[model samples]
Target chain A: MQHPVSEGVLQRPLEFTLDFFGVGEHHLRAMPLSSPTAVINAAAASTNRIKLSTAVTVLSTDDPIRVFQQLATASALAPGRIELVAGRGSSTITFPLFDYDERDYDMLYASKLALLMAVNTDESPTFDGPHRNRPLRDLTIVPRPEEPLKIWLGTGGSPNSVHRAAELGLPMFLGILGGTPEYWARYGHVYRDAWAQAGHPAEKADIAVAVHGFVAESGDRARATYLDYEHRMMADGAAELGRPVPARTDRAAALGAGGMVFVGDPNEIADRILHLHGLLGHTRQILQMDVGGMPQRDFLRGIELLGTKVLPQIRAELGTP
Target chain B: MQHPVSEGVLQRPLEFTLDFFGVGEHHLRAMPLSSPTAVINAAAASTNRIKLSTAVTVLSTDDPIRVFQQLATASALAPGRIELVAGRGSSTITFPLFDYDERDYDMLYASKLALLMAVNTDESPTFDGPHRNRPLRDLTIVPRPEEPLKIWLGTGGSPNSVHRAAELGLPMFLGILGGTPEYWARYGHVYRDAWAQAGHPAEKADIAVAVHGFVAESGDRARATYLDYEHRMMADGAAELGRPVPARTDRAAALGAGGMVFVGDPNEIADRILHLHGLLGHTRQILQMDVGGMPQRDFLRGIELLGTKVLPQIRAELGTP
Candidate 1:
């Protein structure tokens, strides 16, 4: 699946010290955004530093062995610089495509995740599960990376996903779209509680969230420009799902009232990011800006503004150098 | 599988136009050389321009979809600069590890190669081979590269391997590890005949060969040094196969009588390379020098000599830039 938009992003070089790098998902059928491993492999080559991440790589459909090996290969290029954000992704096309039942979602994810962890924990690995058609016996994943990878669970503020991450003692990445800052904050509490209940240390538990964001000369200017682009993408996405598009005007108003959409001047955008950091206490904050055929120059301008102004302001507010 | 020798080789930067690039096989358990794809991916990141290739990525045991995907991913980083030299590797470890029946070797390779070609040929492709457990419904391979990869069939001078390459209309890479240059030259003729018999044009047939070679200050010095290393490696290899090591004296004499091992001074090595090129009419010649824990500095020194001296001499004599 070759998506024109995917090529633009896959070819985008990480020119700065962006702590967490990520590629978005298009599920099984998205032409341009095929698998995250493909883009992440290219990302490994383009950037000397910065983590290789997936906003969400659907774990439910793909075989764990293949995913682990692929991620390990990407990480081998730059050990400790890759994170696989495993998720269901937004598209439902994978079930029929992979010959998987939709009802087996939880069991499949758990089984695959189990296999992945088993393979990683030993050089000569053996995995057998009902989900696997055949058992893998004494297999060694090649290109042994220098260190273990930090694979985060990507959740859409789903309770099960939050609890799964905590139960497994893995890091969590919350996709904070379509929600108020406080609305998603409850998941953070749930995740921490699950982690504590599961006997994992709070210090070791980590959370990261991604929210739609943009920065311009002024708050009004940023919102006005971003809203049109957001509405177009949302409408297209809704149509693809055979759902009626929610009224864009009402959606915009709701986002504006909640400060959920991080579209504003540098100061205002940074303030909301800080506000979320305070509300949810997320260890990392990723701003999803470029999407839905936004003009490359315009998207790049947003990136420049976000990096040069908003990021510095946020870092200063957080007392980080 | 991890071979200690490979790491030393993998770490070397391809600073010049040296012809046969490849990875040696160590099978599943060899701790050091796990798989060629892993090394090739690492090679992809480290080298620029010179073709990154696997000496033989075991095609029978690995998933064709995965192999194609891996190579495609590696090539996406350096489009048109990567070649996958698919081969039935020397190690027999993969058969049991991947649950492949030894009897199905030829059929497995054929079916997988067919699927790989099918996937490479179409954007949204579907393949349902009898050997494959399930039918694949129209699935698109990811990171569609800029150009179709030049996938060469690697053969150890086997007639079947040659016929398969010819029948498939693919280029052949002959791995001539032992025997005299003229002895190996016969396979080149066989391959050409097969290419013609298979209804492929003569001009379409291409061959490349790799041999054990070393470049030293002098012929006498090179032979004296190379023999000890060769004998040690040969003895270990024979032990692995439960066979007696060939007499070192006879082995040395056979190599000296013919232009097999190109271990000598730059002039001597260059002359032999040209001599074999004349005999086999091969378009490309690759020399593997490092073996049996040759000191990293010495191996690198051999590489330096081969590139700095032997290559320049060959190019000048060939009257090519």
Candidate 2:
């Protein structure tokens, strides 16, 4: 008797809402940053089964206490449905305005993560570091959620960040935009190996990959729309990195075509995801359906299709439970 | 009609709840140094109407991000009721556990506070400090409260802390269990004057004092309880400072007799508060009703009496509308 291999699927679809505050567009009217409470409440009301997360909350320039409290509150409000994916967000505006030196990014993230993890524990922590000291007090954080909050470190193609997350026993969220799945294989290996060496339990290291996705009724339409959106996004990202936006269409196409973007129908998109998963061993995949001037309605429709059609089919094929 | 010269009583009853997660006791528990979130949450919820604070959250030894996030979340939940009254919390446990050098206290607070305040602003902040760095991005803190969150510097009779708070336009909450109210007056003046000179509005330089408060149905019971609590607290404080608890019964008697503690009724407590207000010029006062395992029932009763009877009289006398 031949047995079919089970393809991996998330127990249920995890719902994550990208902040509506449009980024990278000069013409876009900046929306107010949504409150953590507002985001958590909205996510809670929208889906009963999806895991809610902030794509990446900037940690380097933020107060750890506030972040912990907000996340904890959200966790309490939605029990096991919330997780915080934090990063030294890609913005220098928070630094100069807050009067922080730009060189301490790595140290800041390290220290902040350490402290954040400590404070979430059951004991009253007394840390005396280069930045803080305090006597031991019987401290308690209020409105704690039912489950321990999961923290994922979001890294923009940084190996050190991946290793650090492993060292800290935190999950890793890798940004794979503008890169091929083959590029992330090394990071995945490093993370898994580090977790093993650290003696953490098996499955302690979780890896998630984020990719830009655009699906349409027809392949040609999807490709065209994806190219348009990709061009604009690449230009903005390049400019933000202080690099000139590539003027040549060939260069733009080259950058987007093989990168972690899926511009096709259900089967094609699913194949791309499976290929990346095979390479990176990532259980969680975040698809950015809306990017760089993509119409909101189209984006929503794409997401709906991905959730209702593509994801289920992929799960069955992959034999994911 | 000619009105007689009447002094305006300022009864700014600022209730501060400092969670002293007894470092020694927590260490004894064989748990990690982090304080339990439940305790903090309970305290925050319990003191809903008061100025909820961590007397000195001891930032030097902890992660600023966690500290800020936790407090910010609490503040958002409570709106204007929360204040992160942080200090270089006393205790060396965080140093070894978190691998911190003792010399980094000043740098840590300054950098952390700068980062915290920057993130709290409407604009994306930028900073290039020795301890941290980030490029400008369209970053904004999610879930900011409607009212501005207050950050108070908890000072251990340190003039530098007072000046720092003043210079930064932040408030100061002084812990004054051992010193005379007169000692804080000089610091208070410096803070106010510095704040004014720093281009802050006149109303920005607020000062709060945290003191021990004990009230009883009878003067004798109050005195006995005050003596016991004060003795143990002073002894513990002295031990922490590497000094002997002072053999000064006369001073204790004077304080008790003069209404610093061991007070009779609501009226008497109110009168003592008025006197302290005159001496310290503190607009907000946090009274420590529970000291050294004082019976929970007694503590609750004292709180009720103060909130219902004592506060009303004091507010009325102060013409607080």
Candidate 3:
């Protein structure tokens, strides 16, 4: 009789992706933001073990209590498998919807973020501030998780955001999709330096590099697939800016090739990740797989291959998990 | 051989108490606010299917996010088993702990409560405010139960609190434990009048009356037990207040005859409840079964007898569930 395999050994372990930075149609089209439940449940069901994250659940356009509540519930359901990368989201739709001005976005985020952190603590937190104020009410969030929930501020290369995160002693998740790998290195350096200057605890600051990636047997096939998606996304992004889509090859190539989209085989993809890691000293890297209506099957295959092949090699090369 | 029992007949039906209010030790002690989880869980597990409620959870003293998280989790575990009676809890502990002052408490509750309701909505909420602000963040609370979570503001005869709850379209659970039943009648009138003035849809305002109770076969036996517990509790309460304990009295006779404590047989208990209901227009009543460490067994027996005997009679008489 053939030997039976154990469930643990034979189970098809799917790779996990950061929930924050999925490159789906919603992210590219800038339509109404999609419900976070679908992606969150997908991560929970799959064997990916990846932290479900939101690259930046913009605080400016979002309610902090709501954000924390939703995220906290998701975290409870999944348990040690979620991260929140909070930022002032890019879309201007929130300003008009909430009757808020862009000028006050910074102050709004600062105050709300402070209140959010304070509220998440063990004690019933009361705060008096410009944006929000509560009196001496005894309150506490119920069903606090066993582990303290992790919150990362997703910064779009903003020094103030970086400094704020450091001052608050929260981890920084840099959005490196728009800039070069070298720029990430500089920002990472500034983040760490600021963190040090702020006299935070000795725990090493964690940095996560978020960028898009696609892989195939051949480089040409990967490039073609990436370009088809990139073109549409760039057009939509340009429309949001009320500017004509720039046709310049150099600009397009710079945007495409500057560590944002890694197109190649496993070895080549791993190499690009390593290069970015080297520059930023980032141990965590989020490869956004579903950019711009890329087929779900293709995305799954990429994640599968990354988990099966690329991640192991990258970890070995980096000497870390 | 015995015939097989039908599925419906064989099933042990679930039992429930229509409504009840619980006093948190935090407010009773006036120092070192107790953990909400401990208080809530203790009340939930210890009490029968009575609607377990915190007479008022001081929202200003604690973090609304944490409170909601805990309450949501508790509700999920119990399912129609928990009701949150939120208030600007009476105490100064929340201020120093959360670094908040008394002045900001009202706005804090207003903003946080708004955000709490917004987040629980189906659509992602966009909010802007001075104290607690969130932009148009696409988020949803996960593991939300099938039933609408019951949220009540514990208004201690405050028209503003009652008006706020009506304006927000939430229920108000009044705290009418301290004074005469006639006082509650005025408070109820004010709440209904404010509800009308708010011009919102007329939703039922749940006025829950919390009172102390004692029961025995003989009135004399009940009265003796009641006085012992009352005198001890009064002394303990006075000690906490840093005031001299009042000389003991036949308060058991006065309050019992005054129809505050239901200290008599099952018939008398039921009658007292009905009279209070008529006086205050309250449909729900929570008896403080365990008053100042009256024997646990006695407390359990008192509640058990009430559940099995007094409640059915009260229900039949009042035409309520």
TM-score of each model, in listed order: 0.84, 0.57, 0.55
By summed lDDT, the worst window of 10 consecutive residues in model 3 chain A runs over: A1-10
In candidate 3, residue A58 scores what lDDT?
Answer: 65
Among all candidates shown, the one with the greatest lDDT: 1
Q: Write the per-residue lDDT of candidate 2 for residues A121-177, one digit (tens) a residue.
A: 643565433333443244433335566677788888787887788888888887656
Let me know the TM-score candidate 2 reaches against the reference structure: 0.57
Candidate 3's DockQ is 0.05
TM-score of every candidate's chain A: 0.90, 0.81, 0.82
Q: Which parts of model 2 are misplaced by more than 4 Å?
A: A1-172, A178-206, A214-259, A262-281, A288-321, B1-153, B159-170, B180-205, B214-271, B278-281, B289-310
Q: Over the stretch A1-321, how does candidate 3's per-residue lDDT look in tens digits?
A: 000011121122332322233311122223322333223322333323446666666676555544554454445445676667777876554464444678888888888787678656643566765665444244544335446568788786787888888788888887655667777788888888888898975466878876666766676677766766766666666675466885734434633446466777778888888888888777577766555557656766676677667778887897865
lDDT of 1: 0.71
Query: Ranking under DockQ, best-scoring first?
Result: 1, 2, 3
TM-score value, chain A, candidate 1: 0.90
Candidate 1 ranges with C-alpha deviation above 4 Å: A1-16, A24-35, A38-48, A60-63, A70-77, A92-106, A133-139, A227-250, A257-260, B1-14, B23-48, B73-77, B95-104, B225-254, B257-261
Error of 2 at A252 (Å): 9.8
iRMSD per model?
A: 5.3, 18.4, 15.9
Cα-based lDDT at residue B203, candidate 1: 94
